[model samples]
Target: MKIYDWFDGPYPARVRIALAEKGLLSRIEFVPVNLWTGEHKKPAFLAINYSGTLPVLELDDGTLIAECTAITQYLDVLDGNPLLTGRTPAEKGIIHMMTKRAEIEFLDAVSTYFHHATPGLGPDVELYQNREWGERMRDKAVRGMHYFNGVLANRPFVAGNEFSMADIAVLGGMIFASLVKLPVPDECEALRAWHARMLERSSVQEWRAMVERGQGVKTLPITADLK
Candidate 1:
């Protein structure tokens, strides 16, 4: 399998971490798409994914899967283990709900603020920006942090006891927030504790190592494990 993505991108980190968790990192090849250069928005890349998003999965048969959730779901079931997604119907429903909520209330909101309010990928990639709307979304993202803090105070994971894609989605939000210098409120102790635990995960450690190794490379095909 080939994954087209930018190294160190928060959204791409989600799927990369999932791949590591599934022990499929050694089997895959990663193709770099430079977000700073606006490669993803270009016509050539847009043909691969209509949404022109990062972290697209391309299979051996040339099947293309876009969107982080879809790719994670596919990978989760590949070994019939479904560890990241969920096995039970109720688990699936709750995980999906919390994941969507994370995206809407946090991750996507931070992305909007980055693209609109901040100089995200520079002037070339950001065709248009809405500063006012972006500021509003920034506020929304902070509110989202507080909301997730409350949720984590009650449960071990975002959805429930088990760590699911919902946790990853929120992790993506936290990653994005950090990149944008949006600090989590000091009062959100539960969220901070949960993030600390997440940072200790082997999958996340692998992802961080990959990011460190990937720095300074431009348009290179980086192996998942760099081995």
Candidate 2:
């Protein structure tokens, strides 16, 4: 099928990682949506996903999946054993629960501080753009990270030992957190180790090169330590 994939952002990167893990990289076409130029807000893209977000997957028959979680789930179905999302009903439930935890904790926090607290991104979503709300969200995310770090301490991956959709979700957020210079406590060895491992992965390395270059000199690198 024709996957109108957006590989310019963290959301797409997670999908890219999942695709790579399943060995489905060559099965789809990659498309880059310029968020810096406000292309996501443009009419043409909004026509597909009214929510106006990237990492949108479009099927050959014109089917469009908007959210990152949905696209990852769809991609999971393409694998031989369906490991990303889960194999059984209970596993699916846990994976979804943990994935939501990652989003609300790390992902939401970075978005609050980056867009609402920082500038030049344009207030496309006013939900957390204001300073007051942004700061509050910052705290929420920090606490969320701590909780996640503790949860990760005894495990190699999220969702109990095995790498699941939860790992992709959390890794995507950590990359965003690192990009925005979010304070990941040095004491959180698990977080650091996990990020370093992810960075070494071929999928992450490939997508990151594109992200850093595509964002241009203007975006630059917020955290020089990311590499």
Please report, in order, the local distance difference test score of every candidate based on alpha carbons: 0.90, 0.72
Global local distance difference test of model 1: 0.90
Q: lDDT by residue for model 2 over 1-227, one digit each (tens)?
A: 33444445667778777777777766666555566666666666666666767767667676777677898888778655787888889899999999999998888677777777766366654434577777788788788788878888888778887888898888878877776778788788777787778678776676677566653112221121211
Clashes (backbone N, CA, C under 3 Å), per candidate, total: 0, 0
The top-ranked prediction according to TM-score is: 1
- Report the backbone clash tally of model 2: 0
Error of 2 at 139 (Å): 1.7
lDDT of 1 by residue, 1-227 (tens): 88889889999999988988899987777888888898888777887887879989889988989899999999999988999888999999999999999999999999999999999999999989999999999999999999999999999999999988999999999999999999999999999999999999999898899898974222445333321
Residue 149 deviation, candidate 2, in Å? 0.9
